[model samples]
Target chain A: MEDVYMGIDVGSISTKGVIITKENKILSSEYIWTEGNPIGAVKKLVRLLEKQFDKENYRIVATGTTGSARKLVGTVLSATVVKNEITAHAVGTTTFHPDVRTILEIGGQDSKIILVENGVAVDYAMNTLCAAGTGAFLSSQSARLGIPVEDMGEIAVKSQHPTQIAARCTVFAESDLVHKIQVGHTKEDIVAGLCQAVVGNYLNNVGKGKKIQSPVVFQGGVSKNIGVVKAFENQLGCPIIVDPDGHLMGAIGAAILARRNKERRVFNFDVEDMEFITREINCGGCPNNCEIICVYRNGEMIDSWGNRCERGDVAARKAANPNAAAV
Target chain B: MDEIRMPKAEYNHHEMVVGIPRSLLYFRYGVLWERFFQELGVKTITSAPTNLKIMTNGSRRAASEMCLAMKIYMGHVESLIGKCDYILVPRILDFGLRRVMCVNFEALPDVVSNIFFESPIRVLSYNIDVSKKLDERRAMVEMAVSMGFSHGKSNKAYKKARKAQNEADSRAVKQNEAKYKNDGITLVLAGHSYILEDEYIGKPIMQYLNENGVNVVRADLVDRKAALRESERLSPTLKWELSREIVGSLVMHVHDFDGVVLLSVYPCALDSMVNDMMLRKNRITHVPILQMTLDAQTGTAGVETRLESFLDILKMRKEVEAGNGREAEA
Candidate 1:
């Protein structure tokens, strides 16, 4: 059987998975909407990948996970490694584009800009407190514009003049968008302006101060928008490299990381049958009342966290142990 | 009904209660201020650590564009309103020429008073304007005199408070300096003492950094006079007192640390300038720098992920330096 590595990235808006051979050749991949259910989303993603997999030729040797729900999904899949989006994205993009100096990622809920030097991440900043210039914001605005979100990029590029929208906050931008629409501006102009506003907001907030050197790669769902890509190129005064599989970079990076730490172990796919549940309980062991979370597989406990004292460990052990009463 | 015994005084000082809002200046002067009041036979009370409700009240009172730290300070003041006979909010002006504070510090007293015009609670204020010759010591004495204390008592209390404040600062400096000798990786965190020391907003990052087993050092712990002098190398004209001191310490001590984290509260005009200056001016080699800005939302998960990624970078950098370059690609 050919040795292959698998990676899964369960994000806030979407979940993606990728399987690659030992030589880093893509075997199969899947991307699905999380729909607020990361667990279900991953299961669906895996099930789709399984249908596409040449099961007889390739055997999954190692698995890794990334994204915000990485820990949960990693534990469920018994992934060899679980990493954050920044590291995963960096590794994935740098592997494909070795000379890339910067990575600008705007996902469904957040935006980030990473500055790389000599293939090493030197500095990075992420948007905090607001989702002003993310994929979700663009999609919501598109829905209000009486156009499909996917069609925005095509419509946006048709305009010769793009209206200016406030990039400081989403509330003001939305109101300005309405005002622009009421003033009988062309739909194409408004669409193009929205893309420009996203780019402006990103540079002002996430890309503030830090020097953005080029050979840049833009990734995540927003990179799929041609209008936004055009706006970024125009604003940055440099063309951005967006790979066709940019949306799957996070998962691919996880796969590469898994391959880097190739471990010899069988992935228990049957464990999917076991019921996975997480429970949060306050440990009254001390005055702090640390909220302890226990992840259970079927009726037994697999892991627990948020315990400040030995009491939490004791509770976990008792739950995991068959003879001891469930705490 | 108080359990502690009271010291002998010419006049009864039991009714005197000084409320300190645990905001901007409180983090820097709370120990000395409380110690002074205690020595004067006056009781002292401070507002609770920041929470959502208090933050909301502060947001309601402040203009949206104001810095997060100032808004949080306003919230602290609001929390103490109607709860204390007098709330202490100092008007910290310039330390000296070209050494000015952010405009918020200079206007804090007026803002609070104007916002709470109908409130019965009196604001106990002390002006610290070294540029105008009304220094901190003089202001404190004047405040004590206005509070109806005798000259002799106020002098003695001020001296004692000064000594106490000095001792407290030295002890902290010594404790932090001790981390320099640790065998593990050390990272210098440059940020406001209030933001780095606050229980509600700052504690999580502090706890996270400490638990990672890396030796942590704070720029605030460095000697202020020496730091101010050290900062001249980076930018002679850059003169925000605490920021200058922090930059100076970073410049002086960046060699001893493996990395630097520039932490700031979002929308800070002062930090925005200083943070950029550090990125452009600091001539350190190979040490990775991360600029983090905290907002109202608890972006703890994202911050933690970034911190972990930073630790990974540090680990990888160390490995490469140690001749294990094979892992660099991995």
Candidate 2:
């Protein structure tokens, strides 16, 4: 059997998992709603992917994880490499498009722009201060418009003239969206306008002051919408490339990273059967009051973090050395 | 910094408590100002650490256009209302003719006064206008006189407090310099002392950095006098006193740090401009920068991800540099 690597991206809204061979060929993949439970979501994702590829054909040698719950899920899986979404996305994109100079990723909760130089991420900016230009905004708007998010792209592409909505702030975007609806604008035009607004807001805020060189690749959950892709191309005055497996890029990147590393953690397929539990405990050691997540396998603690001071070590080390905290 | 333990000296002046809102210049001068009051036989109390309630209450009272830090400061001032005899909201004016603090700093006292116009809390007034020859020492002296301290007592108190502050600043610089000797990644958290030292605001970032196996050296840890002299080359016309030091620290110790993390509170007029300017100057350098803007809405997940990515990038670069050195030697 050939060796295979697994990568799981347990994001806030959705969880994605991908299995790939040593040659970068994706053997199996799955995407599912996280539904506020990352571990359960990832387990279901893995179970679904497990059904896609025959275990006899490839042996899962190592695993990696990324996204908002990268640390938590990485703990559950005992991943070989736990990377952030930015590095994962960069590696995933550059693996396929080595000459790609820029990557514009608008995910469910946040958006980021990665500037690549010589096939490496030189600089990047994630939407730190606001959730103005994100998939959540579009999803909420889609609900308000009584249209499925999946069909929003087709409706937007049908619009001959997109409405002009405010793209400065999320508050303004929401109000402007309602105002356009009250003014009797066509649904297609309004939907297209939203795509434009998201693009404009992202460029004005997250992409502000960024040196955006061409051969730009746009990905993430937002890339699934054709309207957003068209808007980006129109505003950038250049073509925006959208890959079919854009949403799985972070997972793909994680798998690639796992393959590059010298050491590998033997992945257990029986993670689905194992008892994994998480508890959030506040560290009272200092004023930082870091809410640490303690992960336990069966009755034993595996790992913990979230403290900023040496005082918090009593709580963090409680996982492996249970007697350290003195109960 | 809140993490650093200062002298535990206390005063028995129970008649009055001076409320110091832990925002703006408080991080830099809180210890000295508090000590000066203590020396003059006056007790001092600071507002509780920043929280959502303090932040929202402040935002509601302040103008929408005010920066996040200014708004948080107002909230802190509000927290001290009716709890103390006076609230210290220093009116720090221009440093010199061409060198100035942020316009917000210059207008902060007025802003606080207007916000609490109907309230009973008396906002302490200390005008630090070095451009007009009224330096920080003179302002402190005048403030002490208004509080009924004798000229000789005030002079002694100021000297004692000044000595403590100077020693603390020097100690900070020395400790930061020691971090340079370590063979690992070091990040200079470039921001105003207030934004960087606030337990509720800036402390978490420092904590995260510490836990992530990176040493954090505050840009303000560098001596202001020396930093100002070194900063003139970066931008001679950069008027903001703090921003000049932030930019200057890089020029002074650019090679010491593996990367620069330009941390700022969201909606800061001074920081936004300075961050861009500083990044532009260091564009050609190998050192990567992570510009993080913290606001009331900021979460730990986002910050952790960004910092992790930055560290990974730095590690990769270090490996590449090592490989290059080996090839060159061969």
Candidate 3:
């Protein structure tokens, strides 16, 4: 059987999975909302991908996971590699666009700018202390405007004139948008302005003081928005490449990484049916009171993390799996 | 302004236990303080390493706008309450005009005294403002005398403490210098000693870097006069002493390390300006820099992600430099 690889990107808002052949060709792919339950979401996501996967023709040899919930999903899938979304995105983008110099990623709760040179990422910055210019921000503002977030891109591109909305902070932006709406600005113009604000906020915050060169790839959930794409293109005077599979780049990158790994572990699709429960245990052994996350498979603790000291480590392990050996 | 009252107990000063909060200046002058007190035959009790309970209590007592380090300092002060006879709170203004510390240091004694005014807290304090002609030795000797030690004894203790501090500092600098000989990816950790050595805030990052096979060099380990002089090459107008040392160390040894990680606590005024300048003026050096601003939040997820990505970048670049770029994919 041909060797295949599986990759999963479990983010806060969405979960994406993809199965790829040895040559990095996509064999199957699936995307679903996480809905705050990463364990349940990954199980659903794997099942969806399994349905599309050609089990007889391809055998998954290695697996990888990425995004915010990468560790959680990686544990559930027994992934060979668990990597950050930045590295995943950079690797994924550079694989498709070898000369790409920059990656603009606006996820559900965070935004980042990665600068690449010679097929390697050189510099990067993530949004600090705020979630102002992200996909969640756009969707929430779209809700306030009584329009679906999916329609924002089309409506934004229709505006001849865009209103100015302060995008420094969400609180200020929301109040500014309210005032503009009351002042009788067109809905399309306001929507277009919001798109511009997202770009402005991104450039000012995440892309601050960095050199943005050509061959830029904009991925993540917000890349689907043509309005923001237009704004970025207009501001930077450079064409932004939005791959059709842009949202799955993290997953695709993960799969690519899995394919590159020397270790081999055949992935089982039946792992999706396993009952995985994530429980938060406050290890009160010390004043640190570290909240440890213990993942259990049908009440047997499989993995744990988040303890700062060895005392908490021992306490959490004992508390999480009472029947298991002390070691 | 009301005159601050010092608690007057008839007990001998040598028998009185002094509480040193493990925050801020403690990380800088802890060895000196401890050694001096020991020489004076006085007992000292240091507060425990920072924890979640101390952090929460500190947050509740601190002003909303205070930086995370200062808030943690407040928590440390609170932890020492009712535990010792007198809490040592040093007011460090500046070594010189251009070497000034953040205003928080100058205001520490007042802040601690005012915050714990009703808690029966007696503050044992010292002032060091070199521009005002009150040097460290003078300040330290005066403080010991005020604690009822003889002038001769205080002078001897201060001298011994200064000698001990110098040796400790030089040892650290030598250890840092030895890292340059290692044939691996070395990164300079540029931050204040307090933030870089704190148990809750900076220890985890250091541990992670060590576990990842990265050689860590501290920017504060270099000679003070040499670092301050080197800093003038980067920014002549740079004032903060700690910031100057970090910049000087980074500039002096930029070519020695593979990369630099500038760690700063959230909302730090000095670091905000200094780090921004460093990033903008980094055109002189061709090294990758990653800035991580930490807060009181317990989650290390975001920090871990950034660190992992940073290491990946460094490793990939190294591979490409070695002409093995094709094999380093992903």
Q: If you score just chain A, what TM-score does every candidate get? A: 0.91, 0.94, 0.97
Clashing pairs in 1: none
Query: A-chain TM-score in candidate 3?
Result: 0.97
- Show pairs that collide, candidate 2: none
| CAPRI verdict (incorrect, acceptable, medium, high) for model 3 | medium
Every model's DockQ = 0.30, 0.26, 0.59
List, residue by residue over A145-220, the lDDT tens digit for candidate 2. 9999999999999999999988667678878889999989999999999999999989877786677889999999
lDDT of 1 by residue, A1-327 (tens): 878889898999989999987667888998899999877787778878888988777788889999988888888788889998888888788778878888999999889897776676656777765788998889889989989988999999998999898866778888999999999999999999999999999998788766778898999999999999999999999989999999888999999888888465556456556678877776565434456777887866787776645887876665567376553
User: Model 3 over residues A53-160: C-alpha lDDT tens digits?
Assistant: 887888999999999999988888889999999889888888888999999999999899989888878778888856898998899999999999999999999999
Candidate 1 residue-wise lDDT, B208-282, digit = tens: 888988778898788888889988988899978988989888877867888888889989888889988776554
**Candidate 1: stretches off by over 4 Å:** A54-58, A262-265, A277-296, A299-327, B1-11, B46-86, B107-122, B178-184, B276-287, B318-323, B326-330
Per-candidate TM-scores read: 0.86, 0.84, 0.96
Better of 1 and 3 by TM-score: 3
Docking class of 2: acceptable
**Which ranges in model 3 have alpha carbons more than 4 Å from their true place?**
A323-327, B5-11, B328-330
Task: Indicate the worst ten consecutive residues by lDDT in candidate 1 chain A.
Answer: A282-291
Q: State the DockQ, from 0 to 1, for candidate 3.
A: 0.59
What value does the lDDT take at residue B181 in candidate 3? 74
lDDT of 3: 0.88
Interface RMSD of each: 4.1, 5.5, 2.1
Which 10 residues in a row give candidate 3 chain A its minimum summed lDDT? A318-327
lDDT of 3 at B2: 15
